[model samples]
Target chain A: MQQKLTVSQLTKYIKQLFSYDNLLSNVCVTGEISNFKLHSSGHMYFTLKDEHSVIKCVMFKTYNRRLRFKPEDGLKVIIRGYVSIYEAGGSYQLYPEYMEPDGLGDLYLAFEQLKQKLEREGLFSAEYKKRIPFLPARIGVITSPTGAVIRDIMNVLFRRFPNVVLKIFPVMVQGEGAGKQISRALDMINKARAADVIILARGGGSLEELWPFNEEILARSIFKSEIPVISAVGHETDFSISDFVADLRAPTPSAAAELVVPEKDALKRHIMDARIRLKRALAGKIQREKQFLAQLSKSPSLRHPLDKINQLRIDLEQLNKRIENAMERKLESAASRFSVAFGKMDALNPLNVLSRGYSIARSSGKKIIKSVSDVKKDDMIEITITDGSLMCSVTDVMPGT
Target chain B: MDEVKSFEDAVNQLEKIVELLEKGDIPLEESLELFQKGVALSNYCARKLDETEKKIIKLIEENGELKEENFGQEAQ
Candidate 1:
């Protein structure tokens, strides 16, 4: 008969057997997680299961700290670790050294999870985005020092805008500690206020290679940057968390360079166009003013000022002729009336009778014998004529029948 | 003109000059003055665009102070 053993002894023997087996010592198992619990002591206990089977798993604080994503209940995952028997519980379980999400990979799941977390925190809100400068005087680039990513960006930037000042802040694009290195560069650039805009650029790579950009620290750093950030990571298809948090996102490194500054040739063309428009506008204004002046010069009052003066002169001559005619008529009528009055006075005068040769005789004693009745004898007589005065005495009057 | 502050300001002034001239209500002497100013502004803007050279620099920390290093034609 075989010797019997205590429960603890049997369990320890099984644990020893498990430690010696290479397959059980280091193995990868796929299952769904359930009954997950994280103790305050930083130990994680969960059960991973599939449609057909389940396994109890434990990831300690040390290994749990390295997990990129949180494992939840019902989550299918692939764990890499050793299978060992718990001597006290008398059961076997999986002690996972590494855990990853099944099918989708841990990095992608972490990216999605962080993206969701930041989205809820409003880090990707449109209101938080800063406006990119239309003409940035200085552009800061955060990328690898030696690679086509930097070369491509430099070529594009220099070819497009020659006047821009480019400041390169070299950092590791992908690898261990790349995320922290990138975050530090961002902080340095922001602290110095060295550039108007920043370009966080990297060449295309696998999801694993581009993991640094998906870090939460880097996302927050890019969001908190004072300068506007342009995220250009991987190819067009790859969308990292930095791309969502940045002010703008470019498809490629070359594209980011193109977005930072305007093309010199395009600006030159714009200036030329503006110059031509200015000249045309000025020329049109001058032509309009010239036309206005020409219109004023053609006014009737300005053209025929002498015609009005000549008409006034003709009216003055007509007034002078009317006054002269009236004066001459009045003078002739007054002279005729004065001559009539003089003739009437002259007819009443006795001088005309004297010139007609009528005379009167008187006696020598100056008495006139009129009737031949009683007459004194001696009387002196005088005679008067129109041309000479005649004295007659006692002239006899003859009574006309 | 030396009082002009920037290329954009110069361009803005030129546009204003053109607008004032376009109104055609100003005196002849004033219009001529504005035209002369606009011409000068245009010349200044063109010269600013033409005279610039490509510049590349690196940011470095030295003795706990941020400094710049001129990257010459080698970068090109």
Candidate 2:
């Protein structure tokens, strides 16, 4: 100012001062947020203020993605970042790297944040869950090598289904590197194709002890497993992130074993019942067939097959007798008609006149001489009787008056 | 009673035979054959159940090769 420095030069000098100050370079601020605005470029601009003062804040998308809760106006929060001056505006603002709700612990907030994120992504949707195998040939277990959880599971599984194969993958259930170990075991199981189904299990413990199960890495691994996963973590009341991501959830490790396989005695009873039903069904089928055969045998056509032929023979004989009687009547009527015609012909016969001693006289040329005028004196004549003919010459000529 | 057949297969076949017989429309000779096969399958399943014993084995990686060891009371 004493040298009459330009406005841009003064702003540059002040920006360098804020950037170079170690205390101002990194800070933790606790205040109520106000006038929060998230730009289209994914950069957030807000004002963090207390009763006495306020400071401008900006969080890029890179840092905003790391925040667990939604940042809004009037919400009290803690921000850890550094102060930087914007040379163009000549204003210093907090560039936040991390942010959290004021009253919540980091772990709790992280859990909620991850849960909400995965829920929104549909990872925990019912449609994503695979159906657990009814009869798994091999069951893969991921848990502590030496623990009541494993022992209880083994005992229950062996008791229920003795023939089922169980493969245990020893893993650290809690503490440092536990999440990575659990995740690796799942990957190994899937890669090896060692089991038909996987059981992710742990005994009852406090929230801190059960932190590995809540890890995002383990949850994603369980969600992406090719084989169905049954999560059995802690007591009935204890719920973990694995439980929500798994295909099936059992209250305890022993309960998981029980749910995985059917009881041998129950299966045996079922088979026996099936056998009984099979026998009954077969017997009923045979009985039905036998009745059908009996009914067929009792049918009239089959019982007396020749009866129809006998009736047909009787009908043929009656027809033959009627035909013979009709032919006899026709011959009798024909013979009587012939006799009637013969009697009538006999009455017209000229032989009957000859039988009564009558004769017909004819001239020599076969002409009949009915009177003496037809005959000349001394002419020859023929007289015909019924059986004979006579030739005679007339001795006297007489004319009939 | 094929040795290679699984108990589950045997039980499934037995159930199918029962269903076939229950329909009551098959020839008598075929029904008899199915009944005989069903009886055999039932016997095989029962024997399998009675004869099976619990076996627990542990898988270990030795020299990058998976090996099986008998897991018994000693581990417990």
Candidate 3:
């Protein structure tokens, strides 16, 4: 007979046993998940199973917080942890610390890992790859001959830039032998070397549908392509190895064409703008030169090289002649005054006056009486003539003295 | 088409022309030369746009060989 113990005591004993279980702490278990239920409380409960075995597993809220992908039923996962008993239920289970999809179940992880590896290798470097020609004589497309990817690309390229020469290199984009077809298309086109750039595209699909682009062979081919490759394999969220290896990765097939060719409308506008700028700049330069010439031509030195000096000389000569004439006139006037005074003195001399036949008389203390009445009173008088002095008598006098 | 060069070569040449013009130090004679080059580049770009204007109809395989089909309009 066994001794019965209280439920709490039994639970405590089981909890202590689980804490000491070293083998349960860290373990790697791979099996299909079943009975999967995620509680609203943010905890995950499930069972791990294979052909004839199953084990209860619990991913608690804390550990589940680290999961990058949502867990679902029928998914095979590789869990890390050991089997431990819950004290409250006395049930034994695998308490997972971490989990990953079995056999690389997450396609996104594979895509990311490949992307990172390729990036580190510099396969997608802009330096190593050539840019798409601004004006391509021809653009070659490699995709499924009948898919929206090609149509979208074509429509956009046509709408944005019309009259583009597109050569389609039809190939299978999915399923068996897709990698081969794509590789063959690339090889053939490069050999022909007709197109300026190559665009490889496909519509968005499930992971299986996009598997062809993930093939290592296809990625390698894109890297080695002689013509620049633009990979537009799927939607924005979907990425493949081809995307990283190609010269450029576009979010969609339409976007790839946009990258490959220049838009007609935008290009036209750009050309117009460039033309305007060129003309403006040239005209501005020419205008500036003309203005400079005009300024130089306006200078007085250039306009009248000799006239200014000649005019000054003429003015100087005129001033000099005027000064000389004024001085001579002043001297002549002074000489005229002196001559007049001399002439007067000469006239006053008796000898000069006699030549003119004129005479002058003056009454003295002995008066000369010219009239008969004056003769009676006449006394000694002096008289003067132009030639000589003589005793004189009074001459006949008019009435009314 | 005769002006067509490698994409990288053309882009590099275009960049050089832009730089020379931007410096504004070129003589009038040299500036005219550079302007001519810039015109050629713009023309090349126009030609590229013209080339893409042609239509490309994507096709899908209904049986064995691929056939042209419209997108979002059909179920495969």
Candidate 4:
């Protein structure tokens, strides 16, 4: 009798078997893709099918993040991953770690490989890119001399910038030695120090013809140039390695020429505009100053200087009157007080009492006699009246009765 | 600016002066100086744009040495 096993138990056993098998643990499979699904989680799920059978495959977000081309249904690709059993789903699937387009040409493959390698090396980083000059004094162009590319560039450059200086380095833009010649041209341009900026340009061509721009040597040269390089290789849609590494990328040679120099008339107009503004600003400033001076002149204080003086004078007179009034009031109160004191002192004055018919009698020795007992008969005596003292002899002494 | 060396510098300075004066807060002495400087810059820029003719020169590699020649009229 066969031993009974649960579904999970069977799947786990098969998963262990697949894990243990070396051949299943490492695999590289090539087949047409089917049922490709890119989940929102960035995981890629697909099926690989041959004419006879199909195998389920899944590429996790980690593996698929490095893929240059998006994997699609019915596309042929080679995937490298281990065939593993998912115990939860009770199925075995191919877990692809790497994937590449199967039948794409070698040129594209090489391009992709180089781009990925250089990107990993950080050569195409935006931080490494130099800024194109706002306006270049001299523009150095590297391209085939005989082609319309040169003429178009010259036309644009001369038409836009009437006083522009252009330095063109003629080079072969195609075939075997083109990349080396362009590289040498870049070095020569840099060494000469003649150009404010350089433009490496070519017309639209087949990928074979335009391959020189995509060459690593030219790319590295453009990246290494101290002077900013503007790349205009092939058509607008065609992107090359030099385009990525150059300081700026233009769609065409004409566009590069147009970009390198500012239009002479526009610059003239800008200067003229600023000049006019300067004039107007100075004039306006002067006008404002004049208006401000006029306003100041019209101000009450400045307009009639004597009005302020007169107002101050009036205020001074009012203050003087107030002080005089206060002083007079104080003096009058003091005089009244003096008059009252004088009256009281006059009442206490002995001269006033004596002038009122009272007399002070004294002996000749100047002693006062208050009663008859103070003097004897036949004694000389003196009497003090209002105005004078009189000496008399007392005939008889009289008592108070 | 200490000196106006190139058309770009001169124009930049002129524009700055214009902006400064346009604010109307600068003293008269400085405004007069800026106006004089701006006039000089404008004249220099105009002369620079007018006096120089358009020149297109070509670099010919002769015996591994590069030399310059006028290239616009003759595309060689």
Best by lDDT: 4
TM-score of chain B of 3: 0.57
Error at A243, model 3, angstroms: 0.8
Per-model chain A TM:
0.70, 0.71, 0.52, 0.72
Instruction: State the lDDT of candidate 4 residue by residue for A227-344, as single tens digits.
Output: 9999998889998888888989999888888888889889989988988898899999999999999999999989899998999999999999999999999999999999999999
lDDT of each: 0.83, 0.85, 0.74, 0.86
Residue A96 in model 4: lDDT: 95
Tens digits of per-residue lDDT, candidate 1, A13-128, equal 88999999999999999888999999999999998888887778889999999999988887888899999997777778999999999998888899888999999999999999
- Which ranges in model 1 have alpha carbons more than 4 Å from their true place? A1-24, A39-41, A51-55, A84-93, A305-401, B1-53, B61-65, B72-76
Candidate with the greatest DockQ versus the true structure: 4
Backbone clash pairs for candidate 4 read: none
lDDT of 4 at A178: 95
Candidates ranked by TM-score: 4, 2, 1, 3
Q: TM-score of model 3 relative to the true fold?
A: 0.52
Ranked by DockQ, top first: 4, 2, 1, 3
For all candidates, state DockQ relative to the true structure.
Answer: 0.41, 0.43, 0.18, 0.48
Interface RMSD of each: 3.0, 2.9, 5.2, 2.2
Tens-digit per-residue lDDT, A1-401, candidate 2: 46888989888888888879987888888999999999999999999999999999999999897564578899888989999888777788899898888897656766777788788888789999998875677888888878688889988998888787788877889997898888888877787788889999999998778888888889999999999999999899988888889999999999999988878889899899989998899889888988999999999988999989998999999999999999999999998998999888887786887778889899988898888888888899998898898888899987867
